[model samples]
Target: MKHLSPKQKASIALAALRGEKISKLSSDYQVHPNQIGKWKKLAEEELAVLFTDKRKKENHSQERIIDELYQTIGRREVEISWLKKNSSLSYPERLTLANKEHPDISTLRQAELLDISRSSIYYQPTVNPGDIQIMNSIDKIFTQCPFYGHRRIKPELKEEYGINIGKKRIISLMKEMGLNAIYPRPKLNLSSSDKQHKKFPYLLKGLPIIRPNQVWGTDITYIKLKKYFAYLVAILDWYSRYVVAWKLSPTLENIFCIQALEQALKINKTEVHNSDQGAQYTSLNYINILEESEIRISMDGRGRCMDNIFTERLWRTVKYENIYLNEYADIGEAGQGLSEYFKFYNEKRRHQSLDYKTPAQIYFAKY
Candidate 1:
């Protein structure tokens, strides 16, 4: 009949848990026998809650540790990619590093981290003389008429250069050159949608570009070299026609595309960023970056080359004004030459469409 403190009840319950007789515990604590049983039961329940709370805390700690480890891995991978892109590490050294033992990462992942082609690790480069002429012809025809697909390009080759080549060869060469006809085609409905890559509807249609960074377009083009050729990926601000950033890579590898995108984002964030439905743009890494910044991702619908007309025009301007006029001995030479020309194009060259104002002028000063 006496009121007991929680501490007394808990002490009685613990004594019961320790295998002391319930009657003796009740007598010792001067509590009712039934109340002793109740205290013991309550104590048992509380003990379970305590362990449940401990497990939850343990799980949270484990999750935090896992997240930190993943962050560390991500940082390491980013560092490795930066070194591969900017550092003067030789291919063999990169290969060695990629192949090095890492508990959390695999060789394939490490190769991706290094931006080195896994096959190129052992394969040596040899010049195929026959491709030189054909590729050169393809480059010219594509530049003159970008909308020319392999089907149309085949005929142009025969009529213009009198070189009759099969459609399959043209297709193969175009694929190797990473050339896609700049025009709309029927969308192939996939059986299952890729959750990782979300294909966005073309958002630029009927959208007027009244200011800079309203819609920035990016594209890739073939940069011809004497012995070997490389691809150039560039980011162009649509309204101002400003070449925000550009990167040259020896292959149509997606890494360069990502690098250019990151560089452009760093300099200026656009409201609606447009790119052709290239794998590079649709990549999860690329999409996440844009989405995280709250920028809209717009893809040029197939065959809607005009959707990215400014970027297409930029390629023409770059090639006619600089690439063709200057013969590049190597990738380094091409990068250097294009670097200077882009500087001139952005800083000096006047655009009739821009009301005779330069891209830099319009972008920086006007709008």
Candidate 2:
């Protein structure tokens, strides 16, 4: 039999799916008609598995049976080995016996059967020397000077530690680390220049927010981890500082932000929902969701810090109290920390603006 690379197999499969004649496809693709015919036959056989639900049903049953069998064997083998010998079996001998009983089983499958992650099988201490040093410095500086921007931080690094670096590089690293200055008010970051999307004005400037649903604020913030970063979007009750909904994503894509808004709307529809003029918030898809919920749309004025003060404060509290205090090694850790902090912030932490009451207390106490 002639061997074909994956690329050749893919082309043949695609041509077969398109219903191209074998002779013409072979001529165009520069392969023999016999080879094309064999490829088409293989594709037709596999294509049924792709579209048909039978394979999935059979696989499900097979998985359950395999799991039960493996568990039963594992439990019995330990007792059998103890009873058969006064001394324990060697490592290789134990492995050999296990493999003989389950010829098709894999280590990964065994781990899954035991309800453990593959990473737990081979544990290693993780220590990134460079990232640890950078993270330590960032935590110290962020704690000491919460209001210092990247421009100020760059100069401080040079003067204090003699580590000369430019503002752009420092800013990029800060963004990656999810560190930003806690301005007295919100400073719009990375506002969109796309003219295709219509921009809304800051509607709550003079409007009095007396009730819980009168005005809602939304914003996206960066969540940093040792390995990667995630974006968080939250809908907040502007009047009460109560969080309605929130979501985290591995990218700055608009889908997660939209999902958070959708979840918030499901709970209760607000009269107005406000956000900064970032592309994710300003995209037609995002605005349509709010408009469809019959909620009026409002946006922050460009470069104005006071436009979204409530949400800005939320970000400040999250960074200072939770994120900066711990080293999040991954998204899961960051998410867990945020979950705990938001609960405390909404249910326990007293705010001076709310007359020394928590957000949830103020939001519900009024209504």
Candidate 3:
């Protein structure tokens, strides 16, 4: 009559399924043969569940049903609690005394008994008008020709939309919106060379990336909210196009970029890490992490775009698909939305460049 924990029970169940004799299992586990026999009997009666696919299928189905039921129960419980507190019935007697007279009692009772709700739920989000219009225009133009720089985009705005905006303003806006021209094109912004950090040559020029951890590229992109802006830095795998790690910050500081690099390194160490010669990337603190990890540092050639093409493509996809679709009201909303989009990008959305397979699929294909 000894009580067994779930782990002990699982051990017994697994041992019984492996066809080990009861006496042998008892001896090995330092328990009595009767205990082993009892465990075996219990295991045998439920053992089919361990091997049968239907058991897992049913469990998953039941879990989903249970989650939905719990949600419904929670909502009804809130309503019942509200009615009890607000109505004439005392809190303790509300369920019994107010059950018959209350109109919502029936629904609450149904939800409580069945573990489901009958109420409809809807969500309405507020959006900024100016941000919406700007995002819409950015989406349209970026989709048509991703290689068009802000110089070309600024003129297009005036000629096509009749909006007279300066190139500097458009460039600033483009950076804020995380829009960038495709790689191998002209550089939009110049990196600082005044820093004392050592710059490395691009080592991926002729290298064939056949494995996931062979090469990693990092870059920073701007994210625009309704009234403010944030910066996002991501380290991506060159071979699989998978984002290893990412970070968001209010300013284009070196700390946030370094934090992202540290997170990515913790997941998996890469043989070579590449980045543009931006000050943040070239800072001593940022470069030291790679040096400590023994990761080969690679920097894009001055004003060269093709050196970091993959990261550019990632920015383009994110901006067009998620960032430009809606005007985020704050940094929190932008972070949440971008996180969801990245999840979809990594796990669900298929990329043509990756043979129509998701980044997760390609990244784990070899394993």
Q: Which candidate should be chosen as best, given TM-score against the real structure?
A: 1
> Candidate 2's residue-wise lDDT over 192-289, tens digit each?
43567899888887898888888998877666566544567788998889998887655554656765776787878899888777777886667766
Worst 10 residues of 1 by lDDT: 186-195
Query: lDDT of each model, Cα atoms only?
Result: 0.73, 0.66, 0.67
Per-residue alpha-carbon lDDT of model 3 for 89-183, expressed as tens digits?
21112222323344544543432232212120011224456654665565467656667787777767777766676777677666555555655
Candidate 1 lDDT over residue span 1-367, tens digit each: 5576675567668879898766434433346678888888988998887667676688768878799999989978766665655455433345444544556655444554555554434433365767767888898898888878887888888898888989878877777676666556642211112446678889988987998888889887777888877778889998889999888766554656676776787888899989877767776656766887899988877656677888888888888888888888776677768878889999999999988999999998854
Best by lDDT: 1
Q: RMSD to the native, candidate 2?
A: 13.8
Each prediction's TM-score against the native? 0.66, 0.58, 0.58
Model 2 stretches astray by more than 4 angstroms:
1-150, 159-162, 174-189
Q: Using alpha carbons, what is the TM-score of model 1?
A: 0.66
lDDT rank order: 1, 3, 2
Residue 227, model 3, lDDT? 65
Clashing pairs in 3: none
State residue 153's C-alpha deviation in candidate 3, in Å: 2.4
Full candidate order by TM-score, most accurate first: 1, 2, 3
Cα lDDT of model 1 overall? Answer: 0.73
